[model samples]
Target: MVIPPPVRPPRITEFLKPYVLKMHFTNKYVHAQVIHSPTPTVTASVSSQEKALRSSMGITRDVAAVAKIGKILGERLLIKDIPAVTVFLKRDQKYHGKIKAVIDSMIKAGVKLL
Candidate 1:
């Protein structure tokens, strides 16, 4: 019997080394950190999944949701003394429409995806 090779998780460091990575999920959450580092050391992050925001804006397929996540992420990053990051859109999704809108918004708000 033949067996398949073990699947490897997407490595963020492989793409953006020596810099902070701001990875946003399709869900309401955004996770930011330096690659190959521990979770507690996350540079910044945010999510509409938070209690207050979740009640006002339940999960929905609207550009506003993505934008809000971006804004929240930007604010958190600012507070953490991180002024910029390399936006790593996880899972190989194309950058268009809602994602593009959110990314643009982040740039405007000072995320600086590069």
Candidate 2:
């Protein structure tokens, strides 16, 4: 007998659309910011394109790149005395993969996800 695939419940974001802070790191660029949240609240962020970690890591792909961004974000949080924060993994329709690696880095750095 063949087994059927399990059905997953709709994502929380699909309904709640929680506030998201995100950053994108690529071979040549890094963009970071907060999204869908209230105004006047600056979600301190950093990225490779900001010249901080853009050239810090030689390898830009997979876990290497993800680790670099995680370090940057962690540093920023540390400087602000923020012990932990909720993170929304944003990859524009892409799930798991490198995104998972990035989230892992955040967790290791002491981030609390909602």
Candidate 3:
């Protein structure tokens, strides 16, 4: 028999009751936001599609860009007085590569992973 690894604290708690991080990826860009789940409102967001990032980054869809996006999100949340957030990945997505980079960078930027 095989066992699935335990889910992490942040990943287990969806935004239905607390702040959550959401991600959107396209062939040309990466977007992310923090949502206040109960009311379904966005608290903070960042995207590689912004003019400032588009001119600075050669590839918006890359892992490095996603990491930068995560860092930005963390900073934004901190400014909003939100110190922690759980990641809310869609069913089609798994935690790896770009997703992992985002989470790691957010932690490095000082956002407590739920």
Top candidate when judged by lDDT against the true structure: 3
Listed in order, each prediction's TM-score against the native is 0.62, 0.60, 0.82
Please, what are the lDDT tens digits per residue for candidate 1 over residues 1-110?
99999999988655544445555555545433333243335655555556777777756446777777677767766676666665556677688966776677777788
TM-score (C-alpha, index-matched) for candidate 2: 0.60
Local distance difference test scores for all models: 0.62, 0.61, 0.88
Tens digit of per-residue lDDT, candidate 2, span 21-108: 5757566555555444534365666565555555666755557776667766766666766665556664473647666665677668
By summed lDDT, which 10 consecutive residues of candidate 2 come out lowest?
A: 31-40
* lDDT at 60, model 1: 45
Candidate 3 is scored at a TM of 0.82
User: Deviation in angstroms for 93 in model 2?
Assistant: 3.0
Using TM-score, rank the candidates from best to worst.
Answer: 3, 1, 2
Model 2: residues with Cα > 4 Å off, grouped in runs = 1-19, 25-27, 34-36, 89-94
